[model samples]
Target chain A: MNIVIIDYGAGNTKSVQFACHRLGFSPVLSNDKDVIRLADKVIFPGVGQASNAMQMLKKSGLDSVIPTLTQPVLGICLGMQLLCNTTEEGHTQGLGVFDVAVKRFSNTLKVPQMGWNTIFSLESNLFLGLKNDAYMYLVHSYYAEICEHTISQTNYGLNYSSALKRDNFYGVQFHPEKSSTEGAQILNNFLTL
Target chain B: MLTKRIIPCLDIKDGRTVKGVNFINLIDAGDPVVLAKEYAEKGADELVFLDISATLEGRKTTLEMVLKVAEQVNIPFTVGGGISSIKDVDSLLKSGADKVSINSSAIKRPELINELSAKFGSQCVVVAIDAKQIDGQWMVHLAGGSIPTELNLFNWAKEVEMRGAGEILFTSMDHDGTKDGFANEALSRLSTELHIPIIASGGAGTIQHFVDTFQIGKSDAALAASVFHFGEIKIHELKENLRKNNINVRL
Candidate 1:
C-alpha cells in the first residue's frame, strides 16, 4: 500500500518521509491530489500557523480534496488543526473532518512545548500496541479541544485533546515523525491499519 | 509537565570537531557524524553544531556536513555559523535540521529574526547571543567573539525575544571553556524576563555544574562542551545527576 504524505509547504516533511523509508514503507511525498487519492493511507503533516497553512493548501486545491478522501487519513501537528471545523490561528475554515474546533493555548504555560510529553490513550485501536502513557514529541501552541471524537488526551496547564479519531479520519497534535521510538511505533500502528 | 533539557555542543572546524582548554590548543575530537550519532544514541535531548571556522570557507560545505549528521541522527539538531539569509535556513531545514541558529546575522540585522520567524515561525529560529561581562555589565559580542556590539545583553535579549525568536541560546564568553560554571546571574535575569525557552551555553566543567545551572539558572535547557568532548562526563550520566538533584528532566 502506498502511504502518501501531503506536503502543503509545511515543516519536517523529509524527516517524516525518511522515517517511513526506514519502516519499510517508502512514502510518496507530494502535494498532488491524484497521488494522495490513490494511496491506501494518507499522512498529512504541517508545522506552521493554521491560517497561512490553509491559504497554501487552498492554493494547491488540497482543501477541496482532503475531506473527500475515503482512505484512512491522519493529520500531524498543524495538520490536525486543519482537519478541525475551525482554527483560531487564522481566519479560515477547516475541512470539517472532525466536530471539534482548534484554539490557541492559554498564556499560562509556554506557547510551544518543544520536547517529549506523555499522552494517555483514551480509546483503543489507534494505540493498540502503544503503552498507556507513552511519551511523544510535541511542538505547537494551538490544540484541538475534546469533542465527540477525542481518543487520546494529555494535560498541559489543563486537559486538552491530544489525539482524535472519527470514522477513518485521525488527527494528532504531536509529531510522530519526530518523536523517538514511541513515535515510530505510532507510525507503525498507523501503517497496519 | 514539560521536562527541561541538557544539550552537548560540538565545535567543528574544517569538518572536524576541536577541543580547547582556555579556548586554545584545539584538539581533533572525532568525526562530526560519529560524535553526533553517539550523543543522540546516548540519550542527549538535543545537539548544537557550531562551524567554528566559518571565516575560512563558505557555507556549502558546512551544510553538507549538516545533511550527513542529520541522516544518521533522529533527534532535534540546531546548526549555526555564517548563516546570513533565509535561503541558508531553508537549505539547512531541507537537509533535515530541526532548528536554524543565527548569531552574527541576528546582530547585524535584527530584522532577520522577524523575517525568518514570519516565514518559518519563531520556533524554528534560534537567536544565539554571546555576551561577555564587562565592567560588571553583560555586553553582547558578535562575529564569533571576534567583535563587540554596543548592545547590552539584557536589552538585546528582550528585543530579540519581542521580535519573535523561538528560543535564545545565550553563551557567556567569559565563562565559555572556563569550566567554572554558568553565568547564573545572566541566565536568571533572562529566564524570569522572557517567556520563551532559554538554552544556557558555556562554562560547563562538571556534572554538578549542569545541575547547578538548571537549579539556579532556571533555564529550560543547559548546553555544554569540553567536558563531553574530553569524555569528562557522559551525556546520560549527567542527565541522571540532574534528575537526582530534584530537577524535572527526561530520564
Candidate 2:
C-alpha cells in the first residue's frame, strides 16, 4: 500500500518513512496535495515546535488539504499537536480535527515527559495486539488535554491524552517509530487500518 | 507515568566507539552501531552518538552513522559532534535523528538555538552542557571538555531554556566513566532550576546508582554507559525495578 508522509518541514519523516519501508510498505514523501490524496494511508510525524510547523503547513497550503483527508491519517508528536485546536508552544492554531488544545506540562513535574511512558489502551483498532498498559516512547513537553476523542491516556504529573482517534484520523503523542518492538507492532496495526 | 531513563553514550571516532573516564582515557569501546544496539537491549533509555572524529578525520559528521543505528532499533536517539549550523540541524533531522544535541557550537552561537527552534521547534534541539565540579562550582566546559567556559551550569541552563531548547542533556565530565554514582546534588539543583527535562549523564556504576539518582538527584531521566554495555542492567528489568519502587513506570 502507498503510505503518504506529509512533509510539512517540521517532523522526522525520514525515520518514519524508513520504518514504513522496513515494514514492507512503500511511503511517498511529499508536501504535494495530489500525491497525498492518492495514498492509501497517511502519516504525519514531527519533532519541531508547534507554531512554526503550522506556519509551514499554511505556507505549503497543506493545512487546508489536511483536514479534508478521507483516508486513514496518523499524526505523530507535533503532527498530533497540529491536528488539535491550538497549542501552547507558540499560541499557533491547529487543524482543528479534534477539539482539543495542547498545553505545556507544569513545571512542578518535568517539562518534556521524555523516555518511555505507558499508554492505557482503550477500545480502538490502533492497538490490536497491545495489552492494556503498553509502554510507548514519548519525547515532548507540550501535551493535549483530555478530549472526547481520546482513545488512550498517559500521565506525567496528571492525566493527558495519549492517543486520539475520530473517523479515519488518528493522532499519537509519542513516536511509534521510536517505541521498540511495541512500536513496530503499532506500525503494523496502523497499516491494517 | 514513565519510568526514569538510563542512557548510554558512545563517542564515535573513525566509525568506532570510544570511551573515556573523566573525558580522558579515550579507550576503544567497540563498533558504534553494535555497541549502541547492545546498550539498547541491555538497559539504555536512549543512545547518544557523539562523533569525536568529524573535525579531525573529515568524516560524515555522524549523520549517516546515526541513520544506520536508527534503522536497526526503534529507540529514541540523539546525535552530537560537529553540528554547526541550521543546515546541519536540518540535515540531521532528515537523517532520522530524534534530537540533535549541541555543545561548543551552541556556546559560540547562542542564536543557533533560536534559529533551529524557529524552524524545527525546541524539542528537536537538545543543548548539551559538559561541566566539571571545580572549586565547589559547576563550571560549564566547551569543546569536548577541553576548554572551560565562563558560564556556570545553572546560568547557562536557564539561558538555554530561554533561548528555546526543549531539553538539557547535562554531562558531568568529572564523574563520567568513574561509575562512582551521579553528582546527585548538582543534578537536583539543575532539575529544580530548569523547566525542561534534565537528562543526567556520567558516574553510574550499578542499579543502586540509578535508584539513588532518582531518589536524590530527582532527574527526569538518567544516561549511562559501561554498566549497560557490559551486560549489567537490562532496560526492561530496570523499568521493572523502577516500577517495583512505585516510581510510576509504564508497566
* Best-fitting candidate, scored by lDDT: 1
TM-score of chain A of 1: 0.96
Q: Which parts of model 1 are misplaced by more than 4 Å?
A: B20-29, B53-58
What's the CA error at residue A7 for candidate 1, in Å? 1.7
- Give the per-residue lDDT of model 1 (tens digit) for A1-193: 8899998897578878877876888888889999999999999988766778888999999999999999999898888888999988876688899888888778766677677677885594778778877777777777888788999988778778899988889998887776666777888889888
Candidate 2 residue-wise lDDT, B151-251, digit = tens? 99999999999998988888899998798998899989988887888888989887777787888898888887666655566667776777677665544
Candidate 2 stretches with Cα past 4 Å from truth are: B20-29, B54-58, B232-240, B248-251
Q: Which candidate achieves the best DockQ against the true structure?
A: 2
DockQ of each: 0.57, 0.71
B96 Cα displacement, candidate 2 (Å): 0.9
